[model samples]
Target: MSIQVGDRVPEVTLKRLREGLETIDTYTLFDGRKVVLFAVPGAFTPTCSARHLPGYVEHFNDFRSRGIEVFCMAVNDPFVMQAWAKTQSVPDGLQMLSDGNGEFTRALGLEMDASSSGMGIRSRRFALYVEDGIVRASFIEEPGQFEVSSAEYVLEHLPG
Candidate 1:
């Protein structure tokens, strides 16, 4: 089953390119924090680039003002994620994370087989609002859709 509102985030190491390639575990990123983690099927793809990531980039402060740290995650390598962040002009505080092997995605039961598109295993488009290591809300998009997981939607539906 997919991760639910009350599920604890799984422990897995995700990569991010900051000063260097860094491996951060789920516990460190989510424990005792309010976070909005949005996943894309692939970085730099059409909707993800034009709408998804940009939406977060545009509203990074809106989330932060509410005391939530935002993170963008994809199945691509850290290098691609870093490049996408640069190209998108992502804010410094909006973290770009890499689940290169799809371990984290699979652990959440959100992995999709995109082999037909030559992307292989990838994350489904979804967003989660997590507080102190437990999911407070989850917005999982239907296949080939983008409405529910958008930054605007997640922000509107965040639990009080």
Candidate 2:
């Protein structure tokens, strides 16, 4: 079953590109923190590059000033994630998490097979608002829809 608002984020080890291939434990990452985590099917795709990811990057300060840690996650490898960060000139505070094995994505019940599109197993675009590790709100997109998961929408729902 898909994880819902009351559910804690799943325990998983995801790789991230720091100065090296650093591992992040999801449980450790979210503990005692309010987090805004967004997932995209793949990096460098049109909608993701143009709007989804950019929306978060552009609003980084709004999230941080509210004391939320902003993370952009994808099933792609760390190298690609790092490249995307550089390409977009992502501000220093926002994080890019690489779920190369889709462990975290699958646990959230948000993984999808995009093999027909040559993208393999990927995440369905969605965003979550987690307060001290409990999901406060979830905005998931339907197939071919990008309405609710935008950063602007998530901002509106955050407990203020």
Candidate 3:
């Protein structure tokens, strides 16, 4: 089943790049924080590289001012994620997480097959507002759409 509002995020290990090294299973990172977790199909894809990830990176301060930490995920290896992060002048507050093997994406029921495009299993475009590891809101895109997971959508959902 798709994860919904009020659902606790499954205790899944997420691969991330830190200090020039790959870090795995860092679930403790989200503990006691309000996180805006967004996922894209893959790293360095056109939409993901040019729009989706950059949108979050740009509005990271806005999210922090509202007491939310922004996290981005994709079904790429940590090295790719790290290189992608370097490609942009990413702000310090936004975190780039890699679901290298798609385990975390699969656990969230957010995995999708993109083999036709030469990208194996990947994550669907989606975003969630999580507080203390429980979902407060979720915005998942319809297939081939970017209407819901934009920065503006998350801003609109943020409390005043």
User: Which structure among the candidates has the greatest lDDT?
Assistant: 1
**Candidates ranked by TM-score, best first?**
1, 2, 3
What candidate 1 gets wrong by more than 4 Å, as runs, is none
lDDT of each: 0.97, 0.91, 0.84
* Residue 44 shift from truth in candidate 2, angstroms: 0.5
Across 1-160, the per-residue lDDT of candidate 2 in tens digits comes to 7779899888899988877999989988888998999999989999999999999998999999889999999999999999999988899978899999999999999988999999999999999998877888899999878888999998987766
Cα displacement (Å) at residue 82, model 3 = 0.8
Error of 2 at 69 (Å): 0.9
Q: Write the per-residue lDDT of candidate 3 for residues 1-160, one digit (tens) a residue.
A: 8888888888777777676665655357667999999999987799988889888888888888888998889988888888888897777768888888888898889889999988899999999888888888899998789978998888887643
Off by over 4 Å in 2: none
- How do the residues 23-63 of candidate 1 rate in per-residue lDDT, one tens digit apiece? 99999999999999999999999999999999999889999
Total clashing pairs for each candidate = 0, 0, 0
CA RMSD (A), model 1: 0.5
Cα displacement (Å) at residue 157, model 2: 1.7
